[model samples]
Target: MSTDGRSASDSTTASALESASFVRLVTKADGDGLAASGLVARALAARGTPFQVTVGRTVATRTERAQATTGGDGDLTLVVGSTDATNATRLDTDDRPATLAAVDHVRDLGETPDLVLALAGLVAAGVEPGAGESEWLIETARERGLVERRPGVAIPTADPVDGLAHSTRVSAPWSGDVDATHETLSDAIGADLEAETDRADDADASGTTLEHTDHRALGSVVALDAVSAEAATAAAAESIQRVLKPYATPDAPFETVGGYADVLEATAQTEPGTGAALAMGHDAREPALAVWREYGRRAHNALEAASTGRYDGLFVVGIDDGPVEAVAALSTAFRSPEPLVLAVGAGEAALATREGTLPPLEGVARDLESVLEGTGDATDQGVTYDVTASGRRGYLQYDPAVDETTIIETVREYQ
Candidate 1:
């Protein structure tokens, strides 16, 4: 019979039986039992047999309840759980001498199972089957014409101390010297037993050799124990400044390209210039100074060199009305080797202006300072500046620097 409790009509029956879903018996999350359950599921799948497998902590009262519910419809149910003999015995609800006796109760309920696969440890731990019980199980199998014994197949052997082993040398029963029937039953059971054995071995191997590694190593950057956040920040800042210095010039022009006005505003806060720094509104505008600083730093090295001397010509041209002009200004200002900044301040006109030539760095820087000081609004915004020197280009990005309390206050306000 196949695992679905149907008679075999072809050689494939054995395969079908092997693949049919069966109840998995496990004990305490035993790896062996889990693997065995998987093997059983795979075997059923291979044979195109319909089956369902359930897993649980132990073959206890809960498992029995599940089995009663799921097994009545002739569906195979495998329970995997802890395999302690005492625990198994306590869980058995059947009157038979051992936990395997539950098999008979299931069959008696008009559902004859194709097989009963008990994990070795579970069987070893359960109550021993008495002689009467053994004979009764075999007789039931014979009367039902289900093979109880087959030659050349290694049936589960009980340790001498095991009650079931002493009671029965189990075998599949079939009538009339039917070689095919014997072969079918033997092959089916043998495959299942072998798979279980293999799984158990694999579990043992894994337990013995497995090693654990940090999961974060898969993607995160590792830092040395000695590294501190402040130190790292300083290092990064130093590197950026070094890169920026080469492209710096004393007198660079600020172009009216690429929203150069904003760049000018940013530079005014950070970059020193010949002219008095322009003041911005201190109320809501103070927070935005960081943005201006970033823009200045980034475009600082790209300023176009203008007139030299203590009157270094660094200019910042703001496109308060024309966008095209702003972009062009920014582009030109950024191409210089001095601090030429630009600020394309808020307004539609600024965005509409056409591109224009860059001015000197001193003029750009001066204008930047003017705009930053001129606008009193302090809002946090990101600003970007690009610098190129000796064919190498880099970016300087800035965000408003604030303390934890200020950030928390901002977040709470938003919330």
Candidate 2:
């Protein structure tokens, strides 16, 4: 039972998928692809996610990613061959690289998983991915087949096979042999699904198969832009609830009789991720999550098959989330070396820095290092700004104070 006097799994198993949490991506900059990176940062800004587009080898080791990809059009590339790129330990230390490269050379193209994994790695570092960046990463992750991406959730797993097994199963209905009929249909569907995975070169590669048998009716569900997973599951579960009558036995108490099998990325021989079993204690909750998981698996399988046994979408996923909106995210990155200027408020003041550049003048912060390198004076929007140097830092003293919160909020629509 739960603290709310309900089965704990009720929330886990019965609840339908609502909006899921995702991270706003952040990475150590290798001083390359500033234009592309700037574009991506700007894109985030347009969606209310301001980012500071700065350059440095913040990623513990540059060797972690084979080729670093900026968040923009594919033309930009950052190859890390510097002395700092010496460690293979960090890259191989996590399960990300291996899982992302599951199918040898065919899968890990364009550093797609690198970008996704970088964000995942940041979660352990106390940073959260903003809604805009999180959603983009999730959608891209799904498109690349590195993880299951659905409307509200995404999972980049170590094992695609175990990562993708989601099933909603039930007990045998005593009425007409629904269990028997379900098994027959399941077998047929499994075979067809397997056929979908038949590859040209890897004759040994098997087809994708349904995971369960017996009293389960696998409902085919599609993701609607506005509809949540919970809604879909609750709507789908109605058919099952009508089949079983009320029975109150402690050994086999009375309530909803189904749950979704845990979906994960595991090798064939291993079990799927934890808590994937079909059986659940009697309770009344939504079934949308399980359904969504199943659908996520289906989408991955479909993409995998279409990619000629290689998950090709990985390259395209990153690109689709790019360019225009990305340029907008650039405004958030204005960094004036020093805290630039300070905005005053009641008992508090917010410091504002130049993102990368201010509109129409998008240049890599470091590239224009000389601007903050020596003293300068400039005017725009009726305000003249003066800069003075402090060690490697620079200070901005501008006339007519700007509201920090208001400046941050107003600058978000840059794209």
Candidate 3:
């Protein structure tokens, strides 16, 4: 079924699948990086390849170091989002050494990989193929005749739902059950291809549920309990790989965080009681408490309204801490039948609420404005307010309900 001219049971498929590994990098937290990661992951998943993905600066730095010392072990490394690839070791121009010292190191131990698939952006930005410190890499690949270039291929890089749908159509496994599942998901969420696609490629902008879902699904598979704009993209992609594995005919081993919608829905169904509150905090001292108070007020009102028996009796639990602690409190509080919980703060609040850290108040207002006005680009202005000498006390006031645009615009102007 593949170019290797071997049956599925033959070692060819297994070898191809096993010999591949992935390393992802993003130039920034923009739509392009998200789309690229989604597309590449989909391709690898369809081919039954094993991979590991990492994003952000710290992860990227570690990945580069590992690859340089690992030697060329039949692995296909995909680096995404290399805005400035000057310091990259695997790429070279002329006088540079291109040797991936890590790959080379691993090769000496008899673990040579078959291919190295560097994302195009990274390739374009890295040390121009054999100039400065990259000469070693270019020359080595040339000597081994292993530098094969494949161009003009545009993979369908979109959100998880779109990418998965495309992959299902192209790969050998197509089923009515899968189609029905997709249709059900789309209809349940009122999602159309064009709209979902737009949300997926929505630049650095933010969106509501629909927009957030598409964006999140593109990056990773996520469990319903873990819902945050930051984590959704990655979670969705991860989920697709997991759901598809059981049907892979050969029964490939796959894992993914389950969906979170069910959890939210289930929590909403519980009777209102002394539940916990989840809040958001930015500066941790002044604004964090203010935000928590607002969240508490809103959550309490929502819960109370729902408790009227016209809807499910969900309670609100309030948490005042950093994002991490907030998420933890949310997780802990949700286990009981608390009436309401408000999580506030940065790290603690994020943990308690189970929603990633709340964006800065100004950023949140800007994002909300973008959603309401149907514009994708909203300027983010750093908040500046008078604070005590201890930096532990300050006053921040922005009405989320009134003149949201003006407030954000003012912040931007001052910034």
Candidate 4:
């Protein structure tokens, strides 16, 4: 990118980079008053362009100011606050001189730009407009070689967490020996847990249910028919984890380029999980970020749904490896009241909850691990929730006719 107001890329990357869309930072006060950027932001997003807000000029937060002012390639910061000469002068830069309003550019073709909400927000913030202030403001900026028309900038794409990704999110990382675990869970939950593995994935209603990609093993279990609730939950968890953990792609370690663990580590909004493999590298980069975004987005959706009473709770898994990042969505009917979704990585037990963030406390994780080993119920402690499915018996029938969609659906129900 050049120092001139117009952003230009290197010769090798220009053409592809030109397709990247930048941001027009907006403020809450003036944001509701403007229309162009919201429309433009949607247009860009429809085509896969990424945009985010960074508070540059605001009276609200100190942290926001520090982060926004140092904005770079993809950000075009606009402060909708006080516009006294000193404030305005502080906002002046080669690319993003602060403006009291959003500038309207010719969306269709080459033409000059138009300024919107000129000094309106500034007045609201108590900056009195002088005689001929608006015109004079534009004139002085023009003299300083700054124009109201801002160009689109390029977004940074090589992060696991920033943009679109292709990696799949796996809810149950390993569903090992589906049958054995199914029988064990059946005895554990004391009810005939639904055999979710029937490969009924035929799109044309072929009814083929077996799928190799996603090993969605079992569905749900109930304590109603259980002879011994504690024993059932323990059996179910042991049987499932015993098979699933060893079945993971042993060739791809957690830190490997396309490994699910690596993607999780890179794109994670908070710190890495405590169970993160010690030998794994923290630096994991992919060419695109679609996978990470989808995973995080799904996780966020699951969290919000439970919190908002959209659903009582949810249990599911996601697994992705490059090529347009895979996503697993959960519907309302399949949610669980007490979800026990766990994230598995390299033989470690790391759980993330609203209260317990990633890299859960070692002692807490150990205690929960023990609880899962016993009856599946305990008090919530730190980040680990009480294990709800322990020693539970359920039935899962696996067959060869399963398809991708079916497998995904089964996994959600099982979790």
245-275 per-residue lDDT for model 1 (tens digits): 1111111121111111232223222331210
lDDT agreement with native, every candidate:
0.25, 0.23, 0.27, 0.26
Alpha-carbon runs more than 4 Å astray in model 2: 1-133, 139-184, 187-196, 199-415
lDDT of 1 at 185: 31
Candidate 3 lands at a TM-score of 0.20
For 1-415, candidate 2 gives per-residue lDDT tens digits of 1022222332321111111121122222211112123223333333443333222222322333423423432222222112134211111111121111111111111122233333332221112322322344445544665443122112111111221232211211110132333344445334233334312123222333222211122322111211232212232243233222211111211111111111111110022111111111113112323333444333233222221111111011111111111111111112111212232222121222332222211121222223323324222322211111101111122223332333223223221
In model 3, how large is the Cα lDDT of residue 215? Answer: 34
User: Which candidate, 1 or 4, would have the higher TM-score against the true structure?
Assistant: 4
Which residue ranges in model 4 land beyond 4 Å of their true spot? 1-63, 66-168, 173-335, 338-415
Cα lDDT for residue 384, model 2?
18
Query: Which tens-of-lDDT digit does each residue in 49-92 have in candidate 4?
Result: 56543321122221244233544554443322222222111222
Task: Please list the residue runs of candidate 1 whose C-alpha ends up more than 4 Å from where it truly belongs after superposition.
Answer: 1-51, 57-91, 94-101, 115-132, 141-415
Determine which window of 10 residues in candidate 4 has minimal summed lDDT: 386-395
